[model samples]
Target chain A: MSMVGGRRSLVIPGEIIVEGNFRAGLNTYLENGKIYSTVMGLAEIRGRVVSVIPIKSYYIPKVGDIVIGIVTDNSPTYWQVDINSPYMAILQVSDALPRPIDPAKENIRKYFDVGDVLLAEIALFDKLRSPLLKANGRGQGKLKGGILVEVSPAKVPRLIGKRGSMINMLKKELGCQIIVGQNGRVWINSVNEKLIDLAVKAVKIVDEEAQTRGLTERVKKFILKGKEKIDLESA
Target chain B: MDEEIKLIDENGLRVDGRRFDELRPVRIEVGVLKNADGSALIVQGRTKILAAVYGPREIHPKHLSKPDRAVLRCRYHMAPFSVEDRKSPAPSRRETELSKVIREALEPAILLEKFPRTCIDVFVEVLEADGGTRCAGVTAASVALADAGIPMKDLVVGCAAGKVDGVVVVDLCDIEDKYGEVDVPVAYMPNKGLISLLQMDGILTMEEFEKALNLAIDGCKKIYEVQKAALKRKYDFTEKLKREADKSEE
Candidate 1:
């Protein structure tokens, strides 16, 4: 068999990518011993697996994924969080606080009110109900004094790069705490306003040019170039 | 007095100067709206349509949510000034019927079972109407659905053919449709080789109906090429990057 991966082609939904038996991977469907793409993306036929990396898609929460969410509405039982996904997230009071609060006696709104942002992990998502979140874990709770930048969820893997190389580089260069959410939300915490602004710009650039190769290098140059300008003006 | 008007000129060309079995100029723009999860704008001759998709998300009214599969909701609306006359902005009977028709037409191609209990909303707004707005709307909404990154078996396309002046023509404009003997609009999935939507307006002989249906499917096959190009064109940067890679090799 020829190496089909050498000639990567962009395909729309229902376009056949392979003509023989192969395990259908992400964004692909298996029918009649053939593999077809189910979304608009670049097709990759590697060995026994054929997959397509979608260029743009909405967030779908999965178990153990770190996500940034805003508190939309809350009740005594749980707080309704919009994690940029179709299903609303439920942050149970027990999972959110060190000790469970009495719903009837204590005012739950004071704990996590509407419009507050938090970084949490998906404790459970069974595809039958909304995702249940746990925020009481270490380094997981209310996020304060940070800017949230949102991008397409499909670009999240690119923003992170292979084995977190791109994210580690950003953190080292900017000297800031950057949390890359699986739901396409990025949180940047820094004391310097210029550094925060640069991080936001860098995240947007990654989201825009994610389809092309060598994106991490281009982003590095942009940040380095922007950092120099900021230092010069401030000095 | 109205009978004196000729939709087909003496040179055997349509009012829009198209020959029989010829389609209107089709232009599609993907990801046109920034806010919509996925959006596309389709232009087929004088007809202009904007389609936006918002889900695979939560379905409203807890009772409406299905456990086994997602619900495909469609809204086909026309702007007040889309037609020559100022049409009512409210959903008319025809618009309501067309919405269901378009929804059923697109439902077969989508794999709704993957996202159970969610709602995939396809909104098609007719900004300008010529004649084949329903067919144009179906094609636009299909692109928008794919643009949303929803899994589907195939992309659905729509086209219409009708008998006018004892001749069958593809993609009839308003003037031809109004004076034509019969109109047949068809929604087809080329990859699956299936017809999802078929509607007829007026009477036709058995032979003419078969010929018109085949011609409309042929028109759909042609439009499918344009739809695929529009989806791929959304990533022009990818093409440029490939070009640069080839240059480095030389």
Candidate 2:
């Protein structure tokens, strides 16, 4: 059975086929091997069937997404980064850009020590299942001037919200650059340290209240009140 | 040993402002995993442990035979970055001993006779390790097993009491543990009022040991309450869902 306006179940992992006499609506796959109606809005896929999920807002890193990364390590270039996956990913220098040696002045650990969390993309997979990552993207570099908060990897989706709504709220309210590392590490940066602190607190609050409904409105109100309080105090 | 001390003071108030014999904040969430038969994540102070119960499945490797009782396999693993110093990926000897202790601790309470010829693997992963990791593992594992719906005689609560500079302190934090002379970790089934596991390190007089043991038992009793509440919360959630489904059907 096909759905109409409200929602439809995703039946298969392929493109959404809307043929003659077949109605189009928001389709989703059911576990019991049946396609059914959904209560969500309609989603349209391009030319081919929209088999895979959409990637408009917050980029949820898939198994293999070639993105830019930072050199979190030096000697061996052993880097830890987020590819939006569950695992705490690693990027080795051997696998990264292969240009060599200056022992006197250059220290690998200095390049990426304990606190120097970097940005890298997953490269190759080994038998032992370590993510061989690389840093070759445009916007990838050492995270600067941001407060990092570690959270449960499972909560990443909730923090990102349905369609980047939560993150957008923080961006608008705090006016800071917030980058969520898929490995449960969140980096928040702003010119005003207080705004950065507020953003971090807001993210944490959202994380704590992830299971609760209507969190968006609640958070929005919280940010507005916080902003007003700041304004009043400054005035 | 001589690092400027914080968290514990001359007045004996903990950083979080708990008096001596007080435990750090504990939050237990059970049945948190979709895949594991039973799972629990326990956070005591800053330390966090995720315990997953998988099995009563067929024993692997074939040769190690237990004709009567099911073999219990327990693995205690701390994430590489669980502590302040990044630990190596390999399981250290200390971790191995702790794993054995934990396995033995749970054995008596598990009713292994019921699942003879099978094996149960209890995996405890320390996402963050402060102090009292072994005790945390036991507590978390018991809750996870219960969350998995595994029948147990009673839940086990684990706690550590240590003597610092000759003063008996219950629930030693990281620094107290590092410099303190004595540490006695005990796991007990509060419902049965039986000790499942007991271990001590460093030097303690007989009287001191006994006092520490008693304090550990007290600490366990406190933790047991948390374990029960977590289990009840999870059960109530699932029960509520089932009742709603039943109502819909009706």
Candidate 3:
């Protein structure tokens, strides 16, 4: 009848987190009225709900989630993209661009050659089949002329911040176009290289300090102070 | 014609100065490899093993893909200089069989049904060996799997109990294992109280076998504590880092 852990408490696999009246969430499971943690994570308790947030893990692709991938292999019709997950996602030629192309006349490589970066969304996931990605959406295609900064997929939510507050702050203050992938890929495009670097630093700070309290303020100050220093030095 | 080998001395202490019911010092470190999804290094006494877990992802060789569950593949390898005699780089017959057994030992603890048609690969390398390589490897692989954030019912812990001379020791070192009358290695899930891997070599009476099994299980419980402690240490360190970040923000 008593909870075994408090907010921000760390727990390990098989560790009992609650004895009763709690629903397990995320990295936890319930058995015989007892909630148990299933990973090495920090415990979060919200009212009667308990969840464990994993500190380190691979990004598991989910349908409708946006992802950034590196094209690694190609077949006649599809491109194998590495999304920083255990599974390789396939982007079919039909989904690579907005319009269809003649298979016989047009080469698939020209559409999405190997080593290209893609900002795409998971279209369908039939278990046992390679994940199918749709890259035809607006702003979804081969990404170029920007820096790619990688963070932990689990911390991607923090990079986006509450209702996009943190990212919006970064964009409004720094004038950068930012795209965050659920697969832990962040693409930052800005006219100035200094602004892009500042954005990257902000993302890294979020990734490292996501579980900490007051992360938004820390990232904001870090980015703002960094930009001021850069401008001061330039002047 | 032969000199007597004393695995246990007159004071009832092991050659390494441990009691019969005592285990060797075990040190576990998680997240050692950057490229691996999950990785851990375990050093037990003089035995050192590195384990890395990759995937619950796509299965290679398309034919091997299981429609109903994920395939768990474990590779157990000993380095050329792991033992006194330089081992061959090739997988020996013993290594092949140990790999199979080790895989079976860890398979039951994972929730394979959740990741259908994928493959979870566990690679364990013996960097140094004195004794109980299989048990040490299993211990390291379990932590690596957990570190990789693979959901499971529980983490599997392993320990070896052997009858040295006439004493049933909790954990056996090289000298004791060589001269031991019987060696029983066990991998157990403490939460479920299940034995996943149990192997015995040499002779034992019914009573001795039961006692050895109990001892191995008890030893596995001790190992389970260390495993949980190591994981807690990692998470606690992360928590400390978060606290520092929060304080710096204020």
Candidate 4:
């Protein structure tokens, strides 16, 4: 199969991405063995599969993916969570708490009220029903305190990087606790105020320059510069 | 009829100094509206239109939601000041008809099956309407849909061909359309080789109709290139910003 664009080259919808035998991946469709781009963004050809990473898009929920969501409304059994997708996710009371409580006896809003934020995993999702969320997973629960930063859902993968190298680097260098949601919401927790501010700025930079080369190196330098200022202030 | 004034001169040039088969200058800008999910502004000759696309989100009122595919909603509105006499701000009978036709023209290009139980709304506001507003609206709305990152099989483009003074021409101005023998506006998907919208406003001979259709499709093909360029222009800026930062660091 011959690819029309080079690796990581931008492509627009209806543009021919590849010809001959190739698997049509996300943001692409197969027509008579030729793969055509369905979105305007960078085309990624990995082995036999070709997908285009869209430049700007809404988050589509996938089962088992961790996401940060805000509580929009609450019912007796489930609390509606806005995961930045077109579909609203439902977080059941049974999945949120360690023990079950009677719906009529206890107030569900006290546990997860409107405007509250939580980190949860998509337990189930399909076209038939709204996405179901379970917050009982590791590091998944109601979020409070430090900083909250949001980037494009498309850039979430870039911020985390390959094998968590970029995020791991930030954790080690800045000593800040970070949780990245597949839905483009990020929670940054640090005792130092400067570090939290720096982390927020760092994440924003990553969002803007997600498609760039040498991004990890640039972010490392930025954190170092920020750390120096914090140390000087303390001294 | 005001037959005394000539739309086409004896030199074979039209009122705008364009040849009979020539198209009007076209320009398109993508992502013009920030609040809307996706937006675009298109200018074809003296016509100026702004289109916006929102959702693929949950359908309101609940019952309107489609089980198998997303419902496509479209609105085509002309501003009160768009015409010389100041058209009504309310939706006229003509506006309602244009909205439905434009929606049908664009619906084929969208891949609605991917987003079930949702609705995608497209609004095309004719900021300045010279003529052929419906066709131009279709062209601009497709760009807005792409900007919103809605997956589609292909991009949609629209253009018009009309006959003035018994001569066929591609892309008609307001004066030509008003006085022309026939006006044909066509919405086309170039890659798919499909005609989504074809409407004739006046009487035409079989021979004249065939010529007008071919000319309109040709016009659509040329405008399709402009649409693709407008979409790329947004992303190219992001790439350029990254490259400049890398250069400064070195």
User: Each candidate: how many clashes?
Assistant: 0, 18, 0, 0
Alpha-carbon runs more than 4 Å astray in model 3:
A1-6, B237-239, B242-250
Compose the digit string of candidate 1's lDDT tens values, residues B1-250.
Answer: 5657687789999888999989999999999999888899999999999999998888998689898889999999999999988998999999999999999999999999888878999999999999998899989899998888988889999999998988888999988898888899999999879999999998889999999999999999999999999988876667766787799999
**In candidate 4, what are the lDDT values of residues B1-250, reduced to their tens digit?**
5667688899989989999888889999998998899999999999999999999888898899989999999999999989889898999999999999999999999999989999999999999988888889999999999999998889999999989988999899998888777899999999878999999988889999999999999999999999998888788746678678799999
Error of 4 at A140 (Å): 2.1
Report DockQ per prediction, comma-separated. Answer: 0.68, 0.01, 0.62, 0.69
Candidate 1 Cα outliers beyond 4 Å, as residue runs: A1-3, B240-250
Best by TM-score: 1
TM-scores for all candidates? Answer: 0.95, 0.49, 0.93, 0.94
The better-scoring model by DockQ among 2 and 3 is 3
TM-score of 2: 0.49
Write one digit per residue (lDDT tens) for candidate 3, span A57-175. Answer: 76877999999999999987889999988678999998877778887788899878898999999998877677899999998999988999888788888788889988898888788
**Per-residue alpha-carbon lDDT of model 1 for A32-54, expressed as tens digits?**
88888898887887878888888
Candidate 2 residue B109 Cα shift, in angstroms, is 0.3
Task: Supply the DockQ value of model 2.
Answer: 0.01
**Candidate 4: stretches off by over 4 Å:** A1-6, A229-235, B1-3, B237-239, B242-250
